[model samples]
Target: MNKHNSSHIYGIRSILEAIIAEQPINKIFLQKGLKGELFMELESAIRKNGISVSYVPIEKLNRLTRNNHQGAVAQISPVKFHVFETLIESVLASEKNPLFLLLDQVSDVRNFGAIIRTAECCGVHGIIIPKNGAAPVTDDTVKTSAGAAFTVPMAKVDHLKDALFYLQSSGIQVVAATEKAEDDIYAVDFNQPSAVIMGSEDKGISPSILNMVDYRAKLPLMGNIGSLNVSVACGVFLYEAVRQRINQI
Candidate 1:
C-alpha cells in the first residue's frame, strides 16, 4: 500500500480499512466506470456509513495522487469530529452557561478555520456544523485555524435543523446572525446558555433555519458594504458574547 499524505489515503483496500476503522473521513473520490468486487464492497461501506462521495474521472483521481491510487482516493479529516448529542450533553454537564457556535453551510475552508479560531478565543464550549454542506476539516483548514481546530470541539450532524432542535430542547437559546433581522446582536442575551449560528458567505441564513431560531440578530452596519464577511461577522458575534459574559462575571 502506498500512503501519499497524512491527509489522504489511496488504493481501495486502504480506504476500506480506514472506513472499517472508523477514521474521520471528509469525503471519498471514486473513479467513474471502474467496478470490481472490492470496489463494490467499498461503495457499500461508504453508503452504510452515509459518507460523502463523488465519482470522478480517472484524471481527477490522478490529480489527487500520483501514486497508484487504484481508482480510489479518500480525503481524511485532520481532526476527529465529536458526536453531536454526546458533545452537547457533556458541555451542558460541565459548563453552567455553555456557549456554542453553529455554521449554516459555511463552505469556505478558510472562513471555517477563522471561525474556529475565533470561537476558541471567545471561550466557546463547542461548534456544530452540518456534515455535507459545511467545509471539511482538511489540512488547509487546520493551518488556517492556527491550530485552534484541534483545540475547539466540533460536532457534525446529518442536518443542521435537527441539531438546532436538539440544542433548543437542551435549554440552549439559538440565535441566528443575519442582515434581515431587526434585532442587533446586542439585544440577544448571550450571557445565558447560547448557540450563535452564522450563515454562508454568499447566501445568509436559510429562511427555514431563521424561523426556527429563538432570536434572529444582525450586526449594525455603518459602512457602504451591507454585510460583513462570514468570519469577520462571526468574530464580532462571538466576542459580543464574550464581552457580555466577562462583564457579568
Candidate 2:
C-alpha cells in the first residue's frame, strides 16, 4: 500500500491536538520556515515525545491534505498502546508463562487483525509491533479482528530488535517462525515464557531480529504453495503452542 494514503491528519491545531492526545504520529511535515507560538509549542512537544518530524514545502503539505491544513500534517495510531514491561510483569505476577507475538513488519491490516484474533484465542499475553514498519491499527484492522483489538494488549517499540533484547533480558524466550529452520515448531517446549516473531508476507522476519532469537522453527508444509499468509502461519504456530501448554497440565 502507498505509505502516504494509509492514515494522516492535517491542520496545525489538529496535528497539535493529536500530539497532545499522545497519538502515534509516524511522521510530521510542516511548511518550510513557518513559525509561531503554536508551532513552537508543537515543536517542543514533538521533540520531547520523540515523534519524527520533517520540514517540507507548502506544496507538499498541501498535497498530503488539501483542506485547511494550516501548514502541518500527522499520521495517527488506530489502537491504544501499553508498556511492554507492564504486560510482562502482569503475566509473571499471575504465574502465567507469557505468550507474546511480535510482528516484524506486517503492514496488511487484515493480516494483522487476523493474527491478533488468533493470538487472543490462544491466550497470548500481548502483541508487539515496531513503531514504524507495522500496519497502523486502522478501523479495518479492528473490524477484521472482530473487536479483538480492544481485548488484546499491543506494545509499540521504537526498535523491534531492542525489544527482543529486552524480552530476552527479562527471561522471555524469543522464537522466530521462519522456513529457514530445520526443526519443526513442535520440537520446542512452548510452556515456557515465550514470544513468537512473524514477518510480513512479502518478506520474512528481518535478519537482525532473526539473529537475536533463541530458537528458529517452522511449520511442516507439504502443499504446493511455498508460503502461507502471515495470519494463517501465526494461527498454526500459536495453536501448536497452546496445544502443548494445555497438554502439559
Candidate 3:
C-alpha cells in the first residue's frame, strides 16, 4: 500500500502511533469479531481521542489495504478538525455576525468538498459535521474544493441533534433545510447570528433534529427535478445568508 494514500493508516501499531502523535484521525475501521491486547489498546486510544470507529468484516479492511493492516485501519483527515467549543468561543468573540453551516450526514466526499468551498467563499465562520457518517477529507475532496477545504474551519461533533441545541443555546438561530418545510429560504432571518443545517442528498434532516429547528426553509423548485444535489443546495443556502447580510434583508 502507498504510504501516501493520505486517507488511510494501515496496521494496528501505526494507527495507534498516529493517535498517540495527535494525528487528525477521521475514523477507524476494525475487523469484526477480532479481539486481542492490541485491539484493546487501540480501542482505548480511540475512546481517549473520541475518534469515530466502526467494526467491519475482514474483507472490508482488506479492500482498503492489501498491506497487513492487522485488522485495523485509520482514516486521517487532511485538515485538522476544529474544536467546537473553541470555534464557538472565537466566533462569539468576533465583532462580525456569526454565520455557521452544520451538515447532517452528507456522506459524499465530493459534495463535502464543494460545500467547504462555498462556505469559505461565503464567509461562514465554521462548518460542523457529525463525527460518524460524514465523509472524510481525501485528495479528491481537496481537489473538488479547489483547496478551500484546507482554509475552511470545520468541527466534527458527537451528534448533530446536540449541535443544534448547543447553537440555539448560544443564541444563534438554527434553521433546517427540508423540502417538507412550509417556508422558503426568504422567510428565515439569516441577517442575525445563525446556523443552517443541510441534510444528506438522499435523506433530509432527521425528524428529531428538524423538530428542534427554529425554522424550516426550502428552496422552491420550478424545474422537474425532485431535489437538488446536496452541495448545490448548500451553496444556495449559504449565498442567501450572504445576500441577507449584505442587504440586511
- Which pairs clash inside model 1? none
Evaluation by TM-score, superior candidate among 2 and 3: 3
| Model 2 bad stretches (over 4 Å) | 1-9, 24-48, 52-66
TM-score of 1: 0.97
The global Cα lDDT (0 to 1) of model 2 is 0.84
RMSD of every prediction: 1.2, 4.5, 2.3
Q: Which of the predicted structures, 1 or 3, would earn the higher TM-score when compared with the native?
A: 1
- What's each prediction's TM-score? 0.97, 0.84, 0.92
Worst 10 residues of 1 by lDDT: 1-10
Candidate 3 local lDDT, residue 69: 85
Per-residue lDDT of candidate 2, residues 1-249 (tens digit): 112334788877777777777776666788899989988887898888767678999989878776777788886656668877787778778866778899999999899989988988998888988876678787788889988998999988889988898889988899999999999898988989999999988989988888899999998899888888899999999999989988988
Give candidate 1 misplaced runs (Cα > 4 Å): 1-4
Question: What lDDT does each candidate get?
Answer: 0.92, 0.84, 0.88
State the local distance difference test value for candidate 3.
0.88
Residue 4 Cα positional deviation in candidate 3, in Å, after optimal superposition: 7.3
Regions of model 3 farther than 4 Å from truth: 1-5
Top candidate by TM-score: 1
